[model samples]
Target chain A: MNKFYKNILGGKAGIIGLAILAVLLLVVLPSSLQIFRLNLVGKYLTYAFVSVGLVLLWGNAGVLSLGQGIFFGLGGYCMAMFLKLEASDPITTKIQSTPGIPDFMDWNQLTALPAIWVPFKSLPFSLFAVVAVPALLAFILGSAMFKRRVGGVYFSVITQAFALILSLGIDGNQGLTGGRNGITDLRTLWGWDIRSESAQYVLYFVCCLLLIGCILVGRFVVSSRMGRLLLAMKDREDRVLFSGYDVASFKVFVYCLSAAMCGIGGALFVLQVGFISPSLVGIVPSIEMVIFAAVGGKMSLLGAVYGTLAVNTGKSLFSENFPQLWLFLMGGLFIAVVMFFPNGLAGLWESARARLSRLSPRSGAAKKIIPMPAMPQASNLVETEPKLP
Target chain B: MLAYSLSEIWSILIMQGFSGLSLFSVLLLMALGLAVIFGQMGVVNLAHGEFMALGAYTVYLSSQLTEAYAPGFAPYYFVFAIGIAFCVAALVGGLVEWGMMRFLYKRPLDTLLATWGLSLIMQQAFRSIFGAREVTPTLPEWLMGSFKPTETIDIPINGVFVMALSLLLTAGVTLFMFRSRIGLRTRATVQNRAMSEAVGINTGLIDRFTFALGCGIAGVAGAAFTTIGSTGPDSGSRYIVDTFLVVVFGGSASMLGTIVSALGIAQTQSISEFFLEGTMGKVTTLMAIVFILMIRPKGLFPSKVRS
Candidate 1:
């Protein structure tokens, strides 16, 4: 238990980062922002969940899954299905041709509840499906690709294709998946009005708490022995494979973990935003999620959170004011981030601190500062490290 | 399914197959450029689609100009416009290669992100220049009509023209790649960068030229694309995934693989659309490609390489 706690918190630096993030999300933002703005932040924080997962899968494991939106959408859709069911009670939906089905189903002329959606009528089952569905998918895809020794650009392209397939599938099945309009008019969750201001505040807190929890979970994984193997595998797959470890299993596990994290984020997104749509499940949104991780410093879990907030906040501000310039600015951001800042915001902060310490009068003491153990250089030689049995 | 006569089914299949052939031509054109860039150089140019879009807009601009200033030259202008589109797209492609791609050769993933950025910038530029709405160029009268090969089977003249152009372009590219001295040097570099450099090959110049040439083909593709459909700021994006899939599914390095895969993908998609909804057909096509990729991760024809 003590070792687990240490893994989750890292050392002093991780604790400090976690504390700062907690204060900002749980205390500072809530105290400062209006309900409307806080809700927006909550929505942004939900995306942070995906970015955090990317840091684990892409940054740490060197496996970039561009179809994260699939998991996110799956989770959101699961929640939306439950809420829609709750909203479509026989008494309330009596005016429709089908007295107990969702309105979209009625509009699509679905006479009965589809067999697929029947299981989602149970709240516990729906909640379970939110994470399980995404995880199951990741397990299948990850095993298929990794076991075959497929990595790098091929994996990225294939994942993007999956995202495309999912979005089109959802868009095509109007009655089953709510089509392009998506699962809307989600009024309640088991008779609790989710659209209420108080509920929004509560959901916001829930999102923040869950986000922090996810970061800790990510921190745990990154600090574990599995994390070392992942790093070693990323740089030298042949060496790791020759070491008798099942590389594919490790990759599949991390991928599944990331998918589950995205699932939670999507569910929270539906809860906070009051709707879920196919727009969130496509190739574009999946790639955009990657940028959030890239912007935050894919290596830093906390940086992923900050990256999501910063980029999303920038997106909102730019689109709200100078809508025309947003795409250009976003494009430039992508270019600049890749060209100038490959390591992202965390790398910049680390460098700035290094420079500041170098300029300080206590340079001798500064020289003793520990290099961040987590942000290992890409070319870091595994041969220099102690051998793990 | 049983409603149509056997002869009618044959005619319907012929027409659908011809339509698929037009799609195959466009896919081949787009994939050819991607093959050169990604297959030879190992750089994921996400902005390849945008380069294609650039060619389309160039053709659109030329059409508008000829209509306004020189009505008499309208018919001949399309042939020139396609050439102009190639030059413009190639010039821009060369600039982008010099400015961005050169720095990202070692980092394939980073190249993807950077080109995605380039694509966004290109898309926004297109939106700013050409309004957000789609614009279709006026085809020459000769390019507009259908060619009725039989009473039951009619093919669009533009489809035939585009197919011929793509075949010409493909043949030209194949010859240039196999027969030319530069092509040999490009192949040498792909096989062994260090050895090629030792042999006095100017690899950097080859990279830039090949990238530009690829972009030029994409431009021609854009010109071909304008004949069939309208061009919008985001139209290139729609095709980017499908084109990339074709290049990948074909086995990236092999030109023959790309052509075959393009034909297979297009026919499957078109035929499936006949049986299913439009989006469902797309989903089915994509799912099949992904499933095939899972089994054969190296694609249909895995190229022999030392690595």
Candidate 2:
């Protein structure tokens, strides 16, 4: 029992439990338990999952992908395609129902469910595809990019272009993908009643738990040697390369992990929201995820969760109250965070801890209780000496 | 007397070219401001479009004022307001540069993020003040109507005027950049900031004036644009992407590049529209540009190095 508690507190076990709980609360609990706050929490958890993945890839890799929405959208559209197909009437009825021909087999009169969509009838394959597709793509892209060692603004610009192309492509191909308006109107997931107030509440609960799990796991990952190497690469790439670590592999690992996490987030979001639209995944939303991390504290695992909830909540209210100025307000928040608080909300907490310790120098417990400030100061060597290991 | 005579065909072609030139001129003007900002300051300046919007709103306000207080001089007020919008937008540009952009210089990505935020604010502010629907600016009577150059083509009087104005403006700006003391200093600052700083130049002051100048030119573009098109709070959003494309395709660092790319893009787009359907033309042009960018990421006129 002591070992279990110690291991949990030590980080790895704690993170696993957190991840399990989060998945359960988000994926399992909502439909089963019927809790309300948990559903909202579940939604945020999905966002957190994506945000943390961003931290892993962008935050550590020093390659700011302003178009992660491509992966997020891919996962969303895939799942949406399945749901849209299922509720849609089958073959003979579909042929009778569809005008002229389906967008896909346009020449063909056969309106039966396409072979591509058959796997989606089962939950697992759709789930696997959503995560796997993005993983494969990012893995390939990351390998090509890292091998060449493309860095700085050029890399940033290219990724942004990639995002633009994806958005435009999806918008252009409306027949199969549902195009600009995106897929909607379906309200059930698998066999469960998606509209049931009880189901929604349970979903929200699971989301909250999943979020906690993501935080713990994120904390564990960043706390590991792999995390240290990511930070090192971010700061001193050449040095890390000389130190004999396969920088390419490290990057590819993070890239795929982030993509997979984004997939999970997208899947959870679709399940809860009962719809998936390409609108949710785009350069803007992808960029917004970055803002959440930057605002919450890029270095801190918990900050992603904190930033997502805070900014999204602000977006919800301010967008309604001051529709015109909402962007300005959001910009003000971003500027405020970046300029004044580069370390984000987490940094502020760290500073507060530092001040408390300073106020009571004689209190020996302050040394142990305070740990390290969360700020990613250049001089973190002295401040974070003890707790890092 | 013949409609297809060489003289008539020549005149019609000249008229078409004139319209093309006018379109190119405005595009150049907008592109120039963006070039200066990106060139001198190393900022992508997403809010460049918003600055243009600010200028348009200034014109709108001035129009409203003239209608209410001085009906006789309402038309003349437009000419006057164009200048004012330049100064007004420049002033706002300077303030934003100092408050937000100055701090973000060290972190380029943060600058992109921050400016994006600022753009949203500017967009919403305009939406609230100007309303969502586009504002219709009543053009001066003299500026409206077309001049028949030949049997086939009827050229708008304003198109010729706009073309002439754009040429004069470009000539004036080129002279200012090449010959004037402050202009030379601005160019020097862009060329070699560290060296210029070492030689006792105030790079910071140069940055301010450069940003202001670029924004001022955008104001002029916005004022001129109100003649033919719709001006709304979100008008900036429409132009921002195009301006960036112009700047990026032309090469972010050069005034000459901005002019050439703008003219080239405008001609291709217009001519393509003549050939293909509206959207296909756009798609084709966008694809062609994207393909070009793939080959030359720094754009047509890239500076050799980041410094």
Candidate 3:
């Protein structure tokens, strides 16, 4: 139990970090910010789910999926479908040509609910679909790609193409998937007024707690034996494969796990934001999700959350003041993050702490500081086998 | 399913095929540059589309200038513009290679991210310079009308012109790559960088020029694009995925593969678009490419080289 606590919770430093994140998210922000601002933060925390997933998939497993938005959008759309159905109750939607169906469906001349959407009517089903749908898709995609050993840049490109296809598919299917306008006017979840300020506050807390839960899950994964295998596989896949482990299965497992996390984030996103759209599920948003992971120190679970928060905050601020400049700033951030700070904020924090400990002679002497070995740098995370023809 | 007459179906097929050829040319142009950058240098340049856009904007600018200051040169400005676009885009590509890409040779994924950033910056720059609205160059009178090969089949002259230009560029590139001394050096460097360097070939310069050449081709693509569609700040982004897919669907290294894949993709998309909705056609095309890629992970004609 002691070992479990230490390994899973990341020992003393990890516990402290979790405590700080919890207090800040649950106590500090909720108490300080207005409901509107808190809701926005809640929305940003949803992306933190994806960032955390990226830490596991990209950071540890060495698989860079540029289409996380597909999972996020799927989850959001699943929740939105249920909420839309509830919102479009027969009594409320009697004015439409076909009552009880979503307004977008009516607009697109869908007389009855589509077969795909029928399962989403139940809350339990919708919730399950949120995670399962993305996981299933991830499982299919991951298995196909990994089993063939199609990885590295090819994987990223294929994932991106998938993102494009999904967005285009949704946008094209106007009657079925709500098209470009998306499944909007989402309100009420199981007789509860989700739009109310009190509900928003509750949802924010729920999001924070769920986010923390995900981080813990991530920490547990990273500190386990599987994590060591993942690290080894990432640096040297050939060696790992030669060592008699099913390498493809591990990759698929991690990929599906990340997809599930993104799905949860997406569901929470729909809950907080009141609508789900194709705009948030496309190639652009998919790549942006990666930046969150990249900016947060892809290797650090806690850093992913902080990175998402920091980048989103900066985006909100920049876009609000100078919308035109935001793209430039964002571009600069992408370049700067990749070029100079490859390991992200977590890396910076680790190095800073190392430097501080080295400088403080008294503390070092009193604590009998054991000189730790250097952490693996991002540069070493290159593909061992050449991908070029 | 059989709604139309046989001749009508033939005409529709012919016209769609012609339009597909235009798309093929544009895609081929874009993919050629990408193939060179990705296959030769192993750099995943997400910003290659921006170079194409740079070329497009150059044509737009030249058109604007010709109309404003040199009205007599309006008919002739387009030919010069294509060349100027290539030069301008190549210059920018070379600068980017020197400033950014040189530092990211060992890190292909990092290059992808950095190039994405570079693309974003370029998009914003385009937005700032030319307002957010899409712009098109005024084509020469000769390039405007259609060539009626059949009574019903009205093939757009611009489409034919773009195809011819792409063919010319492709042939030139093929010759330059296979026949030229610099091309030999580039191939040698790509095959073995350390060996090439030890043999006194300036590998860094080769890398820069190869990247520039790729961007230059993309610029020509952009120039060709203006005849088909308008140029926007985000136009490059719209094509980036399709271009990357084309390059990947083809074996990344093989020019012949790139051409074949471009043709296959363009034809599939255009013909499908004729029957299905616009977005559905795109979805179908992308899905097909992905499916093919899954079956053959290294692409249709992967080069036989030992890792």
Candidate 4:
């Protein structure tokens, strides 16, 4: 029974954590939250996908990408293209000078759809493109940088530069993209009304299911040999490289995987939010995505999802009432999370659990103490083992 | 597009080249401070541009004060403002280093996120105080207007002033780093923190002072920047990526590389803009930087060092 418990849930705490998230997503949120608010939660859950990917990439592999928004935007734009085309059908857009093409293109005096838009007309193609585009981009970028041994701060700044370039490109190409306003007024997906109450509820459940799947994927990866290799790489890249591991390939694979995750999130974000824009793919939003991961507990995939919900909720609440103080509050959260709670919300939970277990009467015999290294290595990156005593 | 004569095109290229030089000066000023902080301390300070913005705001405030109460002092207020900008930025940098940065020295990624948060606060603070509009200080008579170096090659006096200021600061920084006792200690601490501490060097003080000095230079850069560009709450953010690119492209630890990369990036961006659309120009420059970095990940001029 004990072995089964450990194998299935990883730990007793994991079972409880999973149960709580399931209740929140499957029961409480759909019943309690109104359509408007439920849709907002769905939007926030899309960001959770990115944060979960960040848990794997940053927490495990020590690759802190500040440009996940690029993937997210790419995914979102792909989905938006299909929906925009459907909404701008010849019958619907007959009043415009150019019918059948997207309104923005018509407004910009383009007679035909751009070559890129042609492939996105089919739902299967759009769905495939949503994941493929970001994965391809990440693969190219990751291989280029990682193969050349560019990791750490240089990798981060270069990614941010990429984000800047993409936003600039999208915002400038008004005819192709919708410009600053983004692809909005998205009406349907395959003749189903997206803005309806029933549709919103259905999409929310779909988002929750996808999020759970992502968590399971994260759990599986973290428990596998590849996960151990990532941790090893993070702590000792040189040692891993010396051990005959193709470190760059692993990094590239993880990066591409993470990009694919963000891409999925971005596509979902558009579906729920009804818009996709350049603003969401820019430097500021990209960094904000990192903050969500950091705040949630970069180390925990489930915690990252919760963190996204918590931060986004706080953001909407604060911005609605006190717009001016939001930035200061966010800034304070960033500093506090890093300085006091490096492991974030999940770390707090773990520490609390340890304390609770120790306070129990039978704790002395039940607790298992892990031994520390004789002389802790001089490297600052060494992970400190948790102590029960 | 090529309707102009060959001579006209020649003058246009020269004019654009000079404009690029002006951009190079600003980029160098911002990258210099970032290089010091990131290279020596290994802290990715996202708030570095905000320090520059603080400097720009200082100049604007002083100009306003001079215009309202002391018109006679308007001619010399910019010089005084430049000094004040450095001192103010340095003081804030020292406090931040002491209060927050000291604790985060071990976690570079955390430092990056925390500093980004700090930058958001700073940007909002500026917005609250200065309002959302961009502001520029009125140029004094001496600093205003362009002079013709040749009939077709006119250059703004303010741009020249900024370039001269950048040259002066770069020379001063070089002399201080290679010539001074504190410079020696800073380098020692960066090279071997434990050894420097063992040898009785106050590593903590070195860190604080180095961070402050770096920020101070960024402040002066901001003051110089106000002469060329307008300042707003988000002004710092706009330049942050470009400044970081300059630092990374030049090889983070090499001061000479920072200068060269700054000039190269600025010129490429400026010249390319003349040929392509403005957005495309920026895209091309960024792509070039990424491509170059892929081929030579250590950057164009990596310093010889072993960690």
- Candidates, ranked, lDDT: 1, 3, 4, 2
Ranking by TM-score: 1, 3, 4, 2
Candidate 3 CAPRI level: high
Chain A TM-score of each candidate structure, as shown: 0.95, 0.82, 0.94, 0.92
Model 4 docking tier (incorrect/acceptable/medium/high): medium
Cα RMSDs, all models = 2.0, 5.6, 3.6, 4.0
Candidate 4 regions with alpha-carbon error over 4 angstroms: A1-8, A362-389, B1-7
Query: How close to the true structure is residue B69 of candidate 4, measured as C-alpha lDDT?
Result: 96
Error of 4 at A54 (Å): 0.5
Winning model by lDDT: 1
- Of 2 and 3, the candidate ahead on TM-score is 3
Residue A375's C-alpha lDDT in candidate 4? Answer: 20
Model 1 over residues A1-389: C-alpha lDDT tens digits?
77865788976767888999999999999999999999999999999999999999988988888889999999999999999999889999999998999999999999999999999999999999999999999999999999998899999999999999999999999999889999998898888899999999999999999999999889888887789778878777887787666889999999999999999999999999989999999999999999999999978899999999999999999999999999999889889988998779998988887788899888875564537555544234455455444
Which DockQ value does candidate 3 get?
0.85
DockQ of every predicted complex: 0.88, 0.38, 0.85, 0.78
lDDT of 2 at B80: 93
Clashes of 2: 20
Better of 2 and 4 by TM-score: 4
By TM-score, the better pick of 3 and 4 is 3
Task: Give every collision pair in model 3.
Answer: none
Each model's C-alpha lDDT? 0.90, 0.72, 0.90, 0.88
lDDT of 4 by residue, B185-208 (tens): 999998889999999999999999
Using DockQ as the yardstick, the better of models 1 and 4 is: 1
Scored by TM-score, the top model is 1
